[model samples]
Target chain A: MKANKVLINTLAIAITFMTLVPFVWMVSASFMHQGEANQFPPRLFPETFSLEHYLRLFISMNIVRYFLNSVLLSASITGLSLLVNSMAGFAFAKFHFPGKESLFKLLLAAMIIPAQVTMLPLFLMMNQLGLINSYFGVIIPGMASIFGIFLIRQYISSLPDSLIEAARLDGATDFQIYWRIVLPLAKPILVTLGLFTFMGTWNDFMWPLIIMTRESMYTLPVAMANLSGEHSQDTELMMAGAVITVLPVIIVFLALQRFYIEGIMLGSVKE
Target chain B: MKGKRLFKVWMSPALFLAPALLLIAVFFFIPVVVSFLMSFTDFDIYSLADSSNARFVGLENYKNLLSDPLFWKAMHNTLYFVFIGVPLSLFVSLGTALLLNSKLIRFMSLFRLAYFLPVVTTLVAVAVVWRYIYHPSFGLVNYLLSLIGVSGVDWLGNPNWAMPALILMAVWKNFGYNMIIFIAGLQNIPPELYESAQIDGAGRWQELLHITIPMLMPTTIFVSIITIIGYFQLFAEPYVMTQGGPMNATLSIVLLMYQEGFRWWRMGYSAALAFVLFLILFAATLIQLHLQKRFSTV
Candidate 1:
């Protein structure tokens, strides 16, 4: 029995190392000088740590522009999506309307249809609208989503309706009730959904790859992909790029892990 | 005053819902129909310039895709991924969840963070990092293997090892997600069931087999379905790491569609590929649901 306990603990330690080694190596390798990572024995740590590649990334690569673009896009998509999806989610939760059930059912059914099916024609439509190679091409499609509405609606429905009713009896406009009461009360779910949207938009690769054709407009992920193609030989340089692209989302995730993990449970249970 | 209130009540939902509804209609629903229509026509670069140039070649793209060797290889590779990757991921996820759930382990949060850190990071960035990790001679994986007397294997360079390399990386990236779900499911299982099993003198292994596995069925089904659907669309990893291979070993269905539509401008074929992906997922979900209904006495 004692041996079994030791065995289990050792297993945990081993798997944890296996899980974390790549990230540790990436960070370590990013600090290594050029040609240093190709050591025969495979150095796990940089012997002489340097910031030269990071300097090159900033001065020569203009990665700051891509970084700003990613931040700008993620924040906008989160804010807009929160507003649009919440309004719709609020209506479904508190208000009655004709065709509401069928409409929601239709929306739910549409979830099963993969977004890839829509991309080809969606690209054509973007071209027709002259939104191609523009941030709006990415933003407009993401401004509202079915899953976002469904998530917000589920949470909002669980809140007591008496609050909205009292606000209404006191002559509060529906918008006022939504903006004032529902918004504050629904803050947790909003944070959860907002984190989801922010992280999703930050890490998204394919749509940005399609829409943002201009080098100046590329998100961090798209820019990194482009770099990997051209600078495939520069291990240290590419590792620095990966660290830059990955570090922000990691910080966000760790900072807001409670809300993020809450979102995960809600996703599983709510669905 | 009452009339005004009634008017506001009636018009409010319309105002609240219209913008989102309109956007979804234009961007999502209409585009789905447009793609379906385009799949019937021979839409290429020519038609992309002028609508009149597209020939309504009914079912031709689907017929051609059905017989195309590359499409079949992609289909086979995708199925191979789904079949092997889904269960392997679940196994790892459940293993980690069980380990983390054990009372013997401390620092559960730290362990969880380590496991899940890969999941939230950008896939392209990690794929790039993993590309170097799978390097022929200087890689950590090869070096570690050498210690155990297994000589270096060309991971990304060999067709046989390429898909498995991508799968291992994918599994590493993904298992933490399902692990979280499984942990939740494990916690929700009634402690009374375990207590009763122990009172009946059941050993740990027997209790786990009879009680834990049986109780976790619904969660297992949910995780597997989502995992299958998500794994079916494998693009970014192979794109960043192998570029669909040392010889097309890692080319997936969506990757093929991306190449056909984006690279070659063959919109009709790509649209058809999209529909086919949708059909496959629908069939997969239905099969899972049917199996659930058949076996689930609860």
Candidate 2:
């Protein structure tokens, strides 16, 4: 019994180390001087830690522009989606309206239809709207999502109805009830949805790859992809670029993980 | 006063729902319908430039897709990924979940967090990192292999090895997600059942095989179905890492669709490919549901 316990612990620690090795190498290699990563029997640690690669990424590769673009685009999507999805979610949860049940059901069914189905037409539509290569091109389609609305709806439904009713009885308008009562109460889910939207928009590759034609408009993922093709030899620099692209989402995820995990469970549990 | 109140009641919901509903209709539903219609037409670059150039050629794209070897290769590759990747991922996920759930483990959340870190990181970035890790000469993987007297093999460069390489990276990146789900499922299994089994002389293996697997069947089904669906849409890994190269060994169905749609401007053909993929996913889900029902009845 003791032997078995020892084996399990040893295996767990080994696997954890193996799992984290790539990320550790990514961070370490990003700080190494150029060409140092290409050495045989690859060095896990940088001999002399330097920020040259990071500096080059900002100055030479212009990764700062892509970083800023990702931040602006992701933040806009998150903010707008929170507002749009919360309103829809709140209405679905609290309002008595005609076609409410049917509409919500239709939206639920639509979730199965993969987003790729709409990508072609969305690109064309954006082209016609002259939104291609514009920030709005990326931001517009993501302003509201079915999953976002569904998540908010699930979270908002669990709140006590008496709260909304009391507010309503006190002469609060529908919007006022949502703004003053539901918003504060739904703060946990709002943060969850906000993190999800922000991370999703930031990590988005295909849509932005299709829509954003100009290099100047590219998000960090797209820019990194383009860089990989052009600068395949610069492993350290690419690592630095990867670090820049992935760090913000990791921070956001780590901070709000409780809400994030709760949201996942809420999403998975069939009502 | 009653009429005014009714008007306000009716308008409030509409006002609240208008923005989200309109966006979904215009950007999601309408585009889905348009894309489906587009599959029936010859909507190429010329059509894109001038709407008049597009002609309705019903079923032709799907027919061509049936005859296309590249499409079959893509299908084969995707199935290989789903079949192999799903099992491997589930094994790792289930294993880690069981380990973390073990009474002997300390700091379970820390271990869980470490494993899940890869799932949240940017795929494009991780794919780029893995590209280097698969580097023939100086890669961490090859270096480790060389330590055991196994000469370095070109992971991504060799056609035969490319898909497996991708599958490995994918499993590493994904197993954490299903691990969390499996942990929840594991927790739901009552400890009393285990205690009774222990008292009844049921060995660990027997108890696990009989008790744990059967109890976690529903969660297992859910995880596998989602994992299969997600794997079918493999794009970024190959796009960033291989570009579906080394003789198109890593060319996933979605990647093929992407090339035809965006890169080559065969929009109609690509839309057909998209529909084919959708149908496949739909059918797969139905089969799993059927299997789950059958298994539960037994």
**In terms of DockQ, which candidate is strongest?**
2
**CAPRI verdict on model 1?**
medium
- Could you tell me the lDDT of residue A181 within candidate 2? 89
Against the true structure, what is every candidate's RMSD? 1.7, 1.5
lDDT string, candidate 1, A54-162, tens digits: 9999999989999999999999999999999999999998898667899899998788788889999999999999998888999999998999999999999999989
> Chain A TM-score per candidate?
0.97, 0.97
TM per prediction:
0.97, 0.97
Candidate 1 residue pairs in clash (backbone atoms < 3 Å): none
Candidate 2 residue lDDT tens string, A62-175:
788999999999999999999999999998988887788999999987877888889999988998999999999888899989898898898889999999889878999887
TM-score of chain B of 1: 0.95
Measured with C-alpha atoms, the lDDT of residue B88 in candidate 2 is 98
lDDT of each: 0.92, 0.91
Which pairs clash in model 2? none
TM-scores for chain B, in order? 0.95, 0.96
